[model samples]
Target: MARRRWWELPPAVRGAVEERTGPVRCAEPVATGAVSELVAVLHTATGAHFCKGIRSSNPLAWMHRNEARLNPYLPGVAPRLRWVVERGGWLLLGFERVAGRHPDLAPGSADLARVAGVLSGLASAPAPAVDVRPAAVRWAGWVDPEVVDGDTLAHTDVTARNFLVHAAGVAVVDWSAPCRGAAWIDTALMVVRLVRAGHSPERAEAWTGSVSAWASAPAGALDAFAVARAGLLRERHRGSGAPHLGELADAAEAWMWHRLPL
Candidate 1:
């Protein structure tokens, strides 16, 4: 089946949700990735809600299901899940919109600290045994093996864009890549992305330390995981037209070659 636009949800589904939540005032494309489409805000009588659209063709349905199942267990990590709708070949999940901007827009020691804390909290939560091997295969071209194995619950994609800063606190979103692995995997991914975005090494290191302290992970593993993750990012984005890919690849290569020697 062809992909449907976010505005093209079945009338029945829209009606069903509206009856409970009120009308959807507006929806804007918030984030788009290889597996799923994310919408910023779907206004209802209660308030604005974030909607994540998952394509049936994508194999990350398990991840979404895991997210729905694990949401209750994770505190202050993600927005509250309002509803999950499966229509035709697509799945639409509605969540309370986390009020805040991406962390990149507002960088600070406090913001970084909050992000680290959230990530750690997520890693520490109990989750069912999930087969992360397939994820390793799918993301193998994009991430290092060292960061993709073991029993730790790792949020593989931990870029600044995944965080939402609100008046109350920060909330992390996008669980499509949740995998069982070492905690450092998530930290490594975040540190690499931050460095690629031009954050100083010291700041990135500090953020990594904060995340480790919050998550209770070993500090020595941070540098190795970061190097491996940087390489993975470089390999994945090497030929992409996205301007940031080149910079990220360069930073990853430098960090891997010089600092981590990986």
Candidate 2:
């Protein structure tokens, strides 16, 4: 999908944002990600802050509110939300513009260590006592329901692009798919992407083992997760050229092949 630029927003919406931030001098849109209709760095005389928004009418509009709600409780490693504003049928959020590059989760990359550190911190985060559906309920059709309950807040969409490796540490961004479930769930999600990035299933599992939640996960649960991921990946084959769709499909097959009972 084509990304909308700063100029694309209605004048009323831009004016509303300018009311809080000073006259916008620069609104450079980030050149990646399909989730946001408008995502850019708004530069003022003082400094720059990250901004991303979607129409209030869009189905994913609630994610903006969800991110705002979760930001206070999210681990310190993730960028914090600065403000949330709604105007002219759009919901926008300003974030603590973290400086970083996308993490390289390839098998031999130096950034793998940093990725592990981020996952470890995130594993221990307790879900704020809010009402978000559990992972089991969210992926109920593809996974065993019994193995999905937990209290840890999960960043279930831990694709490689979601993590930014910076000087301070690895920072997670894009809180679009926040879920409350087993902490291992995020690690499991990441493992698939790792495999797609050329890590063997054995190697990916070894990397995941560094995270306590992944190490403590039940064997039965992991088995079910492998099968579930395979099934879900197949279901997501939209026949469109989405990012990493084919590689993930292959990873899914590899995971299921390795974990399925012989």
| Candidate 1 local lDDT, 131-153, one digit each (tens) | 44343564565555553555666
Off by over 4 Å in 1: 1-6, 28-35, 57-66, 105-110, 123-150, 213-224, 239-241
Backbone clash total for model 2 is: 0
Q: Model 2, 14-97: lDDT tens per residue?
A: 998888787889998797667788889999887788999888998877778888877887778778887788999989899888
Candidate 1 residue pairs in backbone clash: 152-181
Best by TM-score: 2
